[model samples]
Target: MKNIRNFCIIAHIDHGKSTLADRLLEFTKTVQVTGGQMLDNMDLEKERGITIKSHAIQMEHEYKGEKYVLNLIDTPGHVDFSYEVSRSIAACEGALLIVDATQGVQAQTISNLYMAIDHDLEIIPIVNKCDMDSAMPEEVEDEIIDLLGCERSEIIRASGKTGLGVEEILSAVIERVPHPVGDEEAPLQALIFDSVYNTFRGVIAYFKIVNGVLRSGDEVKFFNTGKEYEADEIGVLKMDLSPRKELRTGDVGYIISGIKTSKEVKVGDTITHIDRPCSKAISGFEEVKPMVFAGVYPIDASDFEDLRSSLEKLQLNDASLTFQPESSLALGFGFRCGFLGLLHMEIIQERLDREFDMDVITTVPNVSYRIYDKQGGMTEVHNPGGMPEPTLIERIEEPFISASIITDTSFIGPIMTLCLGKRGELEKQNYISGNRVEIQFKMPLGEIVIDFYDKLKSISKGYASFDYHQDSYRPSKLVKLDILLNGESVDALSTLTHVDNAYDMGRRMCEKLKELIPRQQFDIAIQAAIGAKIIARETIKAVRKDVTAKCYGGDISRKRKLLEKQKKGKKRMKQIGNVEVPQKAFLAVLKLD
Candidate 1:
C-alpha cells in the first residue's frame, strides 16, 4: 500500500492561498491535464482573490523512494464560510498554514489557525511572498513562533509567486505530515468535501477515502439522506491532465454517481457501500449558519428568474449560502439572502454580475434583530419587511459584535475614539509582535455595516487589520426611522437607529442621498423622523422645466415624439401619491456619508 498525505491550505484573505495552489499545480506539471492550465478556469475566483468554495487537488510524488499521493484542500477565507473550512479540515490530517511575509498574521489567520488546531491537524507553517520588496520573513516568523506557538524549524520560508522553496515545502509535507490510514478490507466509506457540475458528466463529488477502497460501479448510499446510487466513475483531479480512473484509499478524487444535481451531494456526507455499509456516518460536520441578511433584487424586474437560477447554481457549490423568496411592499419582488458576512455578500454579488451576467440591486446588509411583541411573543426578524408594527413591538434589540483591531501603536487612540463614537465598548488592549498593538472592543453591528473598512483604512493609512464576530444582542432604546420624500415615506430609506442621532444622521444621509439621486421635474422634500417626531429634513430642487423651447410646425411630430418619450420615461419613475420620484431615488437612500 502506498502512503497517503491529506492536508489543507489555511491563510488570511489575500495571503496567497490560491496563488500558492496555482504554483503547486505548475510545479507538479498538473496544469497540462486540463488542456493547457487548469487554474486558468478559475476566472471568477481570480477576480475576487479569495476562494468562495472549497476545492481539492491530487498530486503524485516520490519522496525517498516511496511513492505517495498528496491531497490538498483549499478553503474559503471569509468568516461567513468558516463552516466550510471546518468541514475541509475534518477531511484532512494536516494543514499548510500560509502567512504573508509583509502583512504577517491578521484576524482571519488567527481564526483559521485555531480551527485547524481544533481539528487536531498537524500544522506546517510557511511564510510566502518573500520575493516582494516589503516582505519581512524574519519578523513574521518570530510572530508565528511566539504568538501561534509554531516551531521555528517547521516554519519554511518560501515564495509561491517566484516558485522558490517549493520543492522543500513539498518535502516537508511528506516528512512532517502523517499519512491517512484506511482499512482496505473493511466496508467502503468516503467523506464528501465538495462537488462540481459538468455539462456532459453530471454531478461529480470530491471526497477522501476514510476506510476501505472504493471502486467504480459500486453501489453506495449517502449517510445523511440514506439515498443510494451507483458510483459510475472514480477519477483523480490530475494537475494538468484529464481525470485518471481508479482512485484508492486515502486518495482525493471525484466520484460521478448517477445523481446529477448538486442538491444530492453535501459536504461531510458519508458515502458507504450499500451491501456492507458502515455502522455510522463520520461525525463533526456542523451545519453552517448565516450571520448577515440582505435583499437581492435584479436591476431589471424581468430578470428575476435569471437571478434565482444563478443563486441556485451558486448554492449548489456552496452549502453555507441560504436564500428565500421575499416581497417588499415598495421594493417589489426579491430574495432575502443570508450570508456569512459582508465580504461574502460582495463576492456573491460580484459572481452574479461577472459569472452569470446579472445586474443586481442589493439592500443594505442587516444582522438578525429580536422583536418583543406587546403580547409577550418574541420573534427574530432578519429583513425589514418582516419587522412588526411599532405599537406591537415592545422593545427592539440590535446585534452587537466583538471586534479586534491590530494596528501600529500610533493610531490606537484614534481607532478607539472612532469605535467609541460608533457605540463601541472597550474590552481590552495589548501589544503583539513587539511593535504592533492589538485592541479589542464590542460594537453594534449596525455601525460597522457600511464603510467601516474604508474609514478604518483611511484613519490607519491602510495598515490596520480587523476582525469581528456576533456578540449577543443587548437591550437599547432604539427607534425605526422612516425617511419621507414629499409626503410619502420612502420604504428604501427606512432603518433602525438610536433616537438621539436620528436628526443629524438623517439630515446628513438625506443630503448625501439627494446628491446621489437625479432631480425630477417637481420639488421633493427629504424628511427623517421617528414616528411623528421630525428629526431632520432636506430639500431636493426639481428641474425648472423639461419642455422643448422651439416647437415649429415642421417639428411638431418630433416634439410630440420627444414628449411621448419623456412621459414614458417618467412613467417608470416611482410616484409617491402626487409626487414624481426619479428612478435613482431608490439607490440614493443607500448612500451613507
Candidate 2:
C-alpha cells in the first residue's frame, strides 16, 4: 500500500489530458508506445478525438532505485461526462489538473477543480503544451495561480507532444501525491468504480480495494444487489487483464464471477466476502441526474424486446443512461431514455447501430417539468404526451440552470445577445485576468437543450467554454406544442415550450419539417398547433404523373375529361394515404437554429 499511487487526470475538452496520459505511460514503459492516446482504445473516441469513457491502467515507475506502482485512470474531459470524472476522483487520493498554455483557465477546469476540492484530493497543477510557438506560459501560469491559489514555482510547464517535463511530472506524483491508506486486517470491502460486458466472459467489474484482501475462488456478494457468486477470475488492469491469485488493500483490479445479467453488478456498489462482510456499505456515491430526455424507438416494431436488452447491456458500460418502457402512437413501442447531454444521446444512438446492430429513431430532446393541477397535485412530466390538459393544470414550473461561460472580451456582446434571446438573465461577470472574462447566467434548462452550445461556439469563433448546473425551478407560462401531419397529431412530435417564443418556434418547425418529409402521391399538410388553434402551416405538393399526355392532340373536352378523372383519383388517394415521417424529420427540431 505504501508504494501504490492512484490518481486520475482531469481537464477541459481538447486540453491534452489524454496526450499527457500517453507521455506518462511512455515514461513508465508500462506498454509499447506505438500510437498516440493509447488509453483511448475505443474507435469512436479516436475518430472524434474525444474520450467518451474513462480508462484505467496500472504502471510501474522507479524513482531513485525505489519501485512504485502507479494506478492511472484517464477520464473524459467533456461536461457531459463529468460523472466519470467524479467517480474517478472518488477512488483516488490525488489528481493532475492539466491546463492548456494557449487557452487559459476555462469553465470545465474550474468546475472540475471544485469537485476535486470537495473530495479533499491533493491537486498537482501542470501547464501543458508549453512547446507550441503560440503558447503563453507566463499568462497561463498567472491564471492557474489565480484559480488554484498555488505558488508559481509549484506549476510545472510541460509539453505532451514533445515529451518535455515528463520525468518531472512522475517525480511530482511520487512526492506530492499521498498513497492509499487502508487496513489489510479488516473485512473485505472494495468499491466498484466501473464495469464492462463481455459475450464470452460475462460482466467484468473494475474495483479498488478499500480493506482486507480478495483471493481467487472466494465467494463474494454485491452489497446493493445482494447476489452471491464465486470469483472465477481476479486480476489487475494493465494493457490487458493480468490474472492474479489475490489482490490486497489499496490495489485496483477486476473480478469475474460468472454473473450473466448486467443488473447483478452495479457501479458504485461494494463487494465483500459473503462469510465476513463489512458492517456497512460504502457512502458518498450519488445517483446521476440526467438532464435531457428523449424517446428511442426501434425501426422495426418486433425489435422492441431486442432494444430493451441492448440498452440493459449498454447501461452496464454507461451507468449515466436511464430508461423506461413507453409507447407512442406515431412510433409504436419504444423507451423514453434519459441522457446526460445532447452529445451523450448522439453517441448512444450511434453505439446502438455500430455495436448492437440496432437501427433506432430518437425524438426531439427536452427537459423535465413540474406540472401542478388545480387541486394542488403535482406530477413530474418528462415528455409532452405526459402533460395534463391546460384547463386542469394550475401552473407549470421548468428546471433552470446556473451557467458559467468563459471567453475572450471581444465575444461578450454577441454571447449576451444569444443568451438574452433565450430568456437568460445575467447573474454576474468577473474578469479572470487581463482580457479573459467569466460570465454567469441563470437560464432555463429547456432553452439550451438543443443548439445553444453549438451556437455559442460559432459566435465566439471556438473560443468560448461553457459549463452549467441545475438550479431551483421557477414558475413559467409554458404550453405544449403539437405537430400534425395531414390533420392527425403525432405524439412523438409534441414538445413543451415557453409561450413567448412558441409562435416563432412553431413556424420554424413547420418550415423545417416541410423540407425533410418527402413528397408523396397526395399533398401533405404540415401544421403546428397549440390546442385547437393552428399557429403555423406548410404544404408539401404531391408528385404528379401527367394523365393528359395520352390526349395531347385530341379535342379540348377530351383533355378536360382526362384531367377531371385524374383529380378525382387524387382526392380518393388523399383520404386513405398515410404519411410516413422519416427519421430525419424527428431530429429536425434539433437544428431549428
CA RMSD per model (angstroms) = 4.9, 2.0
Which portions of model 2 miss their true places by more than 4 Å? Answer: 402-412, 427-440, 457-469
- Estimate candidate 1's alpha-carbon lDDT, on a 0 to 1 scale: 0.77
CA shift at 155, candidate 2, in angstroms? 1.9
Q: How many residue pairs clash (N, CA or C atoms closer than 3 angstroms) in each of the candidate models, in the order given? A: 8, 0
- Best-matching candidate per lDDT: 2
Report the lDDT tens digits of candidate 1 across residue range 1-593.
44788998988777888778777777766564333224435676656556767777777777788777788878876655777788789888889999999988765677788778887888999999999999999989998897677678879988877888788888988888888877878887889877766658777787888888887787889998888998788887664224544556777777887676557777789999899999988887777767667888877788888888788777767777889988765667889998876667777887788778998777766667888998888898777657777788888888899999988788988898889988899999998766678899999887776557667867976667777778799977777777777767766557777777677777877777677656776567778877887778778776755566666567578888878877665555536325534435544444455
Residue 511 in model 2: lDDT: 95
Where is the poorest 10-residue window by lDDT in model 2? 546-555
Highest TM-score against the true fold, candidate: 2
The segments of candidate 1 whose C-alpha lies over 4 angstroms from its true place after superposition are 32-40, 76-84, 199-201, 239-245, 299-306, 401-411, 428-440, 453-471, 546-591
Residue 178, model 1: lDDT of 86
Q: Which tens-of-lDDT digit does each residue in 371-430 have in candidate 2?
A: 999999999998899888888999999999999898889999999999999999999999
